[model samples]
Target chain A: MIINVRELLPFLIPLIIFQLLLMISALTMIVKQRRFKYLNRVAWIIIVVVFNIVGPVLYFVMERK
Target chain B: MNQISALFKKEAVESIRNFKLFLLLAVFIIIGIISPLTAYLMPDIMAMVMKDAGIKFELPVVTAVDSYVQFFGNMNQLGLPILVIVTGSILTNEFSRNTLINLLTKGLKRHNVMLVKFLYTILMWTVVYVFGAVTAYLYTIYYWENELENILAAFGLTWLYGIFLISVIMMASAIFRTSFLGVLFTVLGVVIIMIIASIYPMTAEYLPQYLLTSNMSLLTGETGMSDVMPAVLITAGASILIFLLSIVTFNKAVM
Candidate 1:
């Protein structure tokens, strides 16, 4: 079974775009914030950057004061 | 009326500023995209995994039903919890921050506050759910070129289940002082309903939990409209009743 990367690009692009958008927004919020609820700035940056979709969502849902 | 609109506007602005609106929309859109994408890619994924394992197998045909199943499953498992967690603190935040004190003193009716929050949350859920559902539907159609059965009823049932979740959150927030507890109880309430459905089976037709469980069957025409009508009616009624009860509880709640 040969899977063509080019053929899959259109299907994959939106997932990547939405994910990156989410990550960017979450990072922006983390950088702007002086205080966080559960963890420090660097930790959240790592989580938001590392976990793809769930990372930013966890930060937004859990870290907001 | 004026007070309700004012409260609604405040809710909107606050959610926007806090990134709650954006987070909810983004997560839901991703869920929407992932459902059909996963369904469409399942066979390829299976083949890739199987090839590495030195296993020979025939892949089951994936259809539009698989996409719908993924949509409902993801919505129920991932989407609802996120909705609850994100909006769970709607009332508790005001309570903890002491923001409602000034509004209450300024002659804002307690019921109006509850009503606006409920309406706003429902509106958000509806918009996000529709966006996710439509995306899945379009992608599924693009891949399969087949029409699904009972599309309206299937989607509408899931939407109503979402409304039921929002109402649960509303009631839980009204009853619990902390956002964590509010969210916990909302999830627990649904789990309990699920348990009841499983344990009794006889009552499954009338329980709100039936809404989420029956979607695949509804989509495949295995479940008829008349079969789900009771659950649908009960869910709609339960939502309204629970919301009104929440308003009552909110009225008596300490600010």
Candidate 2:
């Protein structure tokens, strides 16, 4: 039942990097924007940071004005 | 021609500034990467869980086909909806914001607008789809040595289905004023087609939804090209017809 971390690092790294880049971009935009369409800044930041890949996507698609 | 290119440039610039392009590419590439990795890890993960329950079952050897199976599944379930939701507002945004009004007033042909949007959607879909497919292919090959059957037809049919979906979205956006409604309509339309296909299996050959559902069989060679040709032709024809209908409706539409 033991899984080796080294065995998974290569596969995990790229996935994590892609997600991090998306989250960071979404966070940067959320911080810079003065207003959003539906939610306030703090709510959006939580959504973007907490929801992994989908939250930031929702922000970019729906909230970012 | 010049107007089309000009409008295309505008679309490109707008998508870039708004991060649509970046988001699409990143999300799809993630899907691409995750698909192969999941296929590769499936057996080990299963073993880890089964070890606790004293269930010993022999798992089949995973191959490149398994990777593609995951790829197609993720693409259909995750990739397509994201594609629809992300680009759903392409035209509705213009309408709601009245951005198209200035262009129409400045002699931009209504048909040209529809055509450019259609082309832009196809271009973006193609780029991201190919990138995702290629990434999955590379990773799948790197993990498994087995070769896939009907690889080109499988991928190409899915790509065509995506184009068909894009046309449906464009038509929906033309009819609905809000991005949310357009996405809802397109998703409902797809579901309706799938429901019909399931209820009347005889009509499955003609439904575009068949393309998405039959891809796994096609990959495994259980579904032949002849079996898929009818749906392919119907989807291509329907895409063109629906696009034309969108333009006709868009022309008569009150801006």
Candidate 3:
């Protein structure tokens, strides 16, 4: 299975981690009451998942408010 | 005009007052000096270690290009990270400490604040880069004679690529309210650029990462100026765009 998904090695794990990080950040924002809008958070979640390091880092910076 | 000059003077004074920056410059200068020195001494160093371990080894002839390659490798990984740690909190730190209030209240526009910050970062970067380059260049030429070709193009591309990295750090600093976030974002940008560039061989020459890779070829005339011009232009252009974007977004964001 490792070799079966060999070509996908880089993307899968990174993407998963990125997703988790995004979720945690978004939930933190929600709990803090800084963000009350769901659509904006969801849009950011999608972006963070797709662009790997750049997206997540950007989210970590840009969407903090 | 006075605002611009005042801002420049203020940043210059701030950088000088921060004694830690002097230490950082010393470290980078040492790295530059030691890199060429190491490449020159690797054979003896390796032989001593290997002999102590009951092993024999033969080392290949090292050239000036090897020293230059060492410079690129070290600067990209170590020196750059130090830069991030040092300058990632420029405006952010000001905001956190409320120091920016005085400056802004003195009639300095928000956009001008961002521009000055970026300019000062670039200015510091240029000073450090020239110090490192001069150290390595003098050392390399003193020991080994390199057959010169497009040396100007080679050096320019390498430095311009470095400018690209500085721009990323500045933009990330603007976007992130904290220093750690700025470092994270800038590093993330580099990694993503490398990964995407790796997907296609044709893109390798144009990627910001290629600046270090093609240094020797560009210097030796093995590659022409036309090959490197695109990459330099792209890196420089992207840097300007990122800086402008950061200024616009930062100006809009309510602090």
Best candidate, TM-score-wise? 2
- Candidates 1 and 3 compared: the better one by TM-score is 1
Give the lowest summed-lDDT range of ten residues in model 3 chain B.
B18-27
Q: Looking at candidate 3, what TM-score does chain B attain?
A: 0.89
Comparison by TM-score, 2 against 3, better one: 2
For each candidate, give its TM-score against the true structure.
0.95, 0.95, 0.73
Q: Which scores better on DockQ, 1 or 2? A: 1
State the fraction of real interface contacts model 3 keeps. 0.00
In angstroms and one decimal each, the interface RMSD of every candidate reads 1.5, 1.5, 15.9
Please give the CA lDDT of all the candidate structures. 0.86, 0.87, 0.68
CAPRI verdict on model 3?
A: incorrect
DockQ of each: 0.72, 0.67, 0.02
Top candidate when judged by lDDT against the true structure: 2
Native-to-model Cα distance after best TM-score fit, residue A48 in candidate 3, in Å = 38
Deviating ranges (above 4 Å) for candidate 3: A1-65, B49-58
- Error in Å for residue B1 of model 2: 1.1
Model 3 pairs in collision: none
- Chain A of model 2 scored by TM-score: 0.92
DockQ of 1: 0.72
Residue-level lDDT of model 3, residues B1-255, one tens digit each, is 778788888888887655334534654666576668668766667777787899865677888888887777787676766666566666677766677777677777988888888888888877887787777787778778776677667767767776776677767766675565655676677757786875698988677877777878877678888887777888888889988888887787666
Candidate rank order under lDDT: 2, 1, 3
